[model samples]
Every structure is written in structure tokens, then in C-alpha cells.
Target: MTTSNGSSGLFISFEGIDGSGKSTQARMLAQALEQDGRDVVLTREPGGSPGAEEIRALVLQGDPDRWSAETELLLFTAARRDHLERTIRPALAAGKVVICDRFADSTRMYQGLSRGDLRAKVDALHELMIGQEPDVTLLFDMDPAAGLARAKSRATVEERFEDFGVGLQEKMRAGFLALSQEFAARFEVINAARGIEDIAADVLARIKARLP
Candidate 1:
């Protein structure tokens, strides 16, 4: 099931704390939609387009303290700008469903939840730079302890974010749930703890109900 953002096609985003399986679900959703004969573009952030990908590596690799919260905020916002311009907007214009693994919400949860209540800054940047929101955002809600365990099992440089540990994962989950309330019009709180097949099926059913 896909939700149209009142544009040419649907813009769907999967959001959750790391290891919530949103990434895998994003891939599955894309494949399922394609099998259904729908034109779909599956992508992700803090990278999606070429330029944004470069930024992605910069932000995701290296020491955990590589960049300050404010600096990381700028980098993420820039990446999102490029992604929207080069990938998401065009796909939508072509009338193809665009499923992003993560989007601006990650920035909000990661940076906004950081010290000093930086959410306002994140929101300001989003409002000023990337003004578009997804048609439907599937929030993969689950236990932080389980999610952190899953994240720790990965052997990738992208560990920068996930390495923050389980405590933060709990906070991130809460933040995502709060975001669902803020953008209730387009947010679907999916139980990520369920079996992958069951979660995917639920997501499909929900999205199909919103397809134009």
C-alpha cells in the first residue's frame, strides 16, 4: 500500500532506530511494489543521490565524535537537499513510487535528540532547505535492547550512528513515536518486533489502502 503525497506519485519512507529492520523492510517494500508492476524507486539517506552519498560517507565513518552535533546537522541537511533534488523529486515527477530507507526524521531524531534541545534547529533547517515530507512514513517500533543487539552484529563503517548504544536507541524510539503524533497524517506505527514477513505484509496492506 502506497500513499500519494498529493503529487504525481507516492513518496514512502521507512523510519526507526537502527536495527529496527526498516532498511530490510524498505528493500522488501520496493521489491514487492515492483513485482506488483508498479514503478518504484528504492533509495536511502543521508545518501541517495551521488553527491549526497559522498556526504553520507563523511558523516557515517570515522570516530564516533568525529563531528559535533551542529556540524553533523549541517552535513545531514545538505545531504537531504541533494537527495530531494536529484533523486526523490524526479522519481515522483515520473509518477514512480519512491521508497527511502531513512529520511529527514533520522536527522531530527539523532540531532534533535542530542543535547540542548536541538530539534528546533533541525526543524528550522528542514523548513528552510528541504520543505517536502513523505506521503507515508512507516515507523518500525521495537525494543531498543533487541535493536541495539542487532546493530552491534553488523560489520560496517556505518556503525558511527548505531554505536551510540542501547540507551540512545530507547530515546530514538521514543522520538520516532513522538514524530508519529506530530505527523500523524502520514505516519504508520508498525510493530517491528513481529516476524519480518508479517511486518511486511502489514505494511503492504496499509500502503495499498492508500494508493491512488
Candidate 2:
């Protein structure tokens, strides 16, 4: 997890299955960095900026049959563009530590696993929109079955992806692992099958070691 400019400012993203504890860890990491006197901007994909939030609702709440795989990919990219332009990129340029709960990787994994051809289009759009990548990405590696169980136990309502069958979730988990390997230098896989504090501690240690 090396940084190009020695981490005076950093952009970190969290990726994982539905219940992989990314949001919790992302918040904890951001708070820890803030305590260390680093300016931190905590945000999430699909619902960061105002425009993106609207798209998020449509994507997560609207009828899945209304959207094709290609449409789903485009909608995710649309939200991402808004998020990057309005929230992420600005914070990074201002020398703030940007910790995003999810980013482009989620789209790649979900859409890649579900829609084969759409994956390539999403990748191309990602390159066009988010020209600069995250300095570090923490991947919460956990079994899809366990993650789904945890997610269902925690949530009263299921989002569109949450409603996806176990098989798709398993495939998405595999996609994440494969993507992590492909970007080994920038992506760190964290064992997320532990207590929250334990996971947070490990994540903190990883970030501290990577940051200048």
C-alpha cells in the first residue's frame, strides 16, 4: 500500500460483500485518522452526492425488471461520476483523507458476476470518469453465506442487491477476491469474520503502516 506522494493526503476505499462490515470499519478508520489530526472525509458510493443519492434510491428501490444489466451499469457509473466530482475528488485535492464505504469495485464485482458483457462497459466508463484511483482499498474478505446471514439479521428491509440470491452473492465474493489479486499493490484484503473492534484494530494498523 505505497502512496505516490507519501500520503500527505490519501484516498481509501472499502469493498466487500453485503454484510462484510465495510461501512462500520470505514467510519472507525476515518474517526481514528481524524483523531490523529488528519482531515478526513467519510462518504459512500451510490449515495454520496445529492444527485447520486437520487440514483441510489432508484437503483436500490425501483423494480429490478425495469433495468437491464447495461442500464444498471450505467446508473452506477452515473452515481459514481456525481460522487467523484462533487465529493471525492474535491476532498482529495484539498488534502483530506477520503474514506469511501464503496466505490467502482463494487459495481465491477456485482455487474461482472451478474452481467458478463456489461462488465467491460463499466470498466471503460470507470476509466473515463474516475481517472485517478484510490490510494488504498481495504477488502473485507468473508464467506458469502455468512455475510448474507449477517445482513439479513441486521436489516429489516432488503435492497435490490440484498435480495439477490445466494449464488449471485457467492459469485460477487469471488469477483472481489479476483479483483483484489489483480490490484494487489493498492488493495489489502482484511479478514472480516472477527469482532468489530478486532477488525477495526487490524484495519487501523494497515492504514497506519501504509500512510506516511
Residue-level lDDT of model 2, residues 1-212, one tens digit each, is 33553335788999999888898999999899999999999998888999999898877775546577778888888898989889987776677888988888888887755656567777788888766678889999998999988887775443677777678778888889998989998999999999999999999999988775
Backbone clashes, candidate 2: 0
Q: Estimate each model's TM-score.
A: 0.96, 0.93
- Root-mean-square deviation per candidate: 1.8, 2.1
- Which portions of model 2 show Cα errors greater than 4 Å? 1-7, 156-158
Give me the candidate number with maximum lDDT.
Answer: 1
lDDT of 1 by residue, 10-128 (tens): 99989998889999998998899899999999999989999999999999998888998999999999999999999999998878999999898888899888433799999999999
Off by over 4 Å in 1: 1-6
Error of 2 at 104 (Å): 0.7
